[model samples]
Target: MNYMISIIIPVFNRKEYTRECLLSLGKQTDQRFKVVIVDDGSTDGTEDMLRQEFPEVEVLKGSGSLFWTAGVNMGIRHALKQGAQLIMTMNNDVVTDEHLIEKMYYWHEQKPEALLGALELDANTQQPIFGGERLNWLLNTIEEVLPTLPKDEQKGLHAVTHLPGRGLLIPRVVIEKIGLFDQDRFPHYIADYDYTHTARRAGFELYVNYDARLLTYPEESGERQIRSDKNFKNYYKHLFDLKGGGNLRDFTRFTLKNCPAPYIPFHLANGYTRRLFGYFLK
Candidate 1:
């Protein structure tokens, strides 16, 4: 299918990473996609570098406040205006596989109505980290179940409750209907989760295409909110910070929206119990 697939990449000051990502995209066997990069408040000459090296990529500006969620939305909106048939949201910190587009296109052709995401691997180790994820209320954790599957078994589209924005592909129709990510509530972390959950509620099936894989830098991506080094005072202060990964308010809202109503209280308490305990004990 020679559809107009626009790849929307939200970037900050990571010109090198974005360059590598674009280079990888340039090498794809299926080069039928257009790349729209949202260079939000990049002071590191990222925009200039892109304009020079990757002249084909459409570079869009963002208000300095625009984080990952809003940044991606900027690109998505631009793509929509440009008459894209499919919109694939990506991060600048990843080097996509040569077959990423080809495989995603294949699965998309197979399931046009369903939302698709690429299986993400660690750039260095080549280990699958985020193939697909689901909110496991019983365990009070967001589980990456597809990556745990054996290599031979990870071939087709594995249904998932949520998908990361790393290489998430959505048909233009879905975005036209369901709308953009909730940056006001979840600016960065878990924004993709909330969007996917909303899409699921709106009668869209989400899946991870294992055959469509991309290599991403886990270290360079979002930071750990519950890290040992982060002091309790700072953690509490930023508990509701929009950019903080899986922060309290966003997590609560997501759980309320996605989890079973009966399990919500226990689910939230169970998850927060460890978080609160860890900080207090420390």
Candidate 2:
């Protein structure tokens, strides 16, 4: 039988974080998956370290800076060409639980219609980082309020609207149906959301495996954290408008109401709005 899954990891100059990420992959309990690391031109010894430590992972070479979407596309293309039926794109900074692959695969097997399946990512300090959420209005992104303790330490399952790309698993069928990620609109940030939204529109579902878990490093997170940066809001507002069309206005409002105050809507709004005006000015 073909490989059940391919874990695609795209790395840049962040070898420090990539090291931990690779180690966690090494510790996975499921062995039905192959690890493919796409090094997007790292001058900071990331390539050397991967050569030494993760020789087994298929390494794809790229220029130093292809951005997140491009790098992910490279890795995904390689995985598909190598005969993987499923692809899991993970961030280089996060380390996952051992049963992550097994749980995710089970979810996919049971629910093949789930186009995007993600795990709950916690802060390195074990704080709740991302587990998907209902869109918020004011913040304009998914909210992560309380830390949803580790799987072995958790109770019941929780549902969410979108999946986090940091540890997201996508089946080959879904990718074929929806097409690969859009490289034009998003070089980073919100691109995953755009991809998921497209898949959802195409009759696919997005979900979270409450039992699958991972850890990340989030510098900005806390209660009553007010991050209404005009610059950030304006930039992303224009980005969404250009890509998502006028629907972005309402979409932005939807995001703000669902996402946390400091993270979503505001920051993305600034970025999208700025890009929109810049386009006309030029």
Candidate 3:
């Protein structure tokens, strides 16, 4: 049976980025999909812009509390209600090839029960930034594995442990089985890992389609440190900040949720403590 496709984007205030993302979607080789924007209290008149610019796209307003996870959940809920059999979640700061959806659909049709991801390349250098990832809890390291995969897999879809929410495709059955992202524990950060890991445990395969390519502004990602002075105060400040990459609270929660019971503490200490050392000692 043919499935209705929906691409869901969550935007806070980056209106220009959202505009560019929408434009790329419009130029897709396959226009057999709809767009949904979950605007979580964008003070930059994003709502007005969408109304004036792309009125055909649906906009859902939130009370500013919903961050990435909740916003995506909101979009998925709406999409499901609108008869969306397949849902794609993405970040706004991205542009795509004209055949991105077509390529993703082509790979997804081969194994419909799996979670599919689009290859994310850096917008400037055209180097792949994110394609697929393997989380090594023993070493507490996450490696970008798509480029190093077997050639056959490179030409096709590469199986993975988890896929980021950026340009991730979700079949309706996965949601029906595993439910939505755990927004309460992972509102803004680490939510994608949690969702995909959960889906993997629930018997869903994760694959990244290298042929489905999109350009993302890697420099515009979450902040890493407050300063280079190695000030202890700055380290502590950014460690728990929701928008920073060193979100210790969220990372700890993610480890506990995704890792095996015996490995949770080791993963946190071995991975984060070492990384924190770099932010301070280095």
Best candidate according to lDDT: 3
TM-score of each: 0.91, 0.73, 0.92
Ranking by lDDT: 3, 1, 2
Off by over 4 Å in 2: 136-158, 220-282
* Best-performing candidate as measured by TM-score: 3
Cα lDDT tens digits for candidate 1, 44-145: 999889989989888888878888888988888888887788999988888899999889888888899789998888899998887787766676667777
In terms of lDDT, the poorest run of 10 residues in model 2 is 220-229
For candidate 3, the 10 contiguous residues with the lowest summed lDDT are 221-230
Q: Candidate 3: list runs displaced more than 4 Å.
A: 147-153, 224-234
Instruction: Give the Cα-based TM-score of candidate 1 against the true structure.
Output: 0.91
> Is candidate 1 or 2 superior in TM-score?
1
Write one digit per residue (lDDT tens) for candidate 3, span 1-282. 566689899999989999999999999998888899999999998899999999999999989998898999999999998889999999999998899999888888899889998888789998777778887777767788866766566656878899888889999999999998898998887888899999999999998888999898876876533644457676776576777567788888888888988788788787686657767654
Which of 2 and 3 is the better model by lDDT?
3
Model 2 Cα displacement at 271 (Å)?
Answer: 10
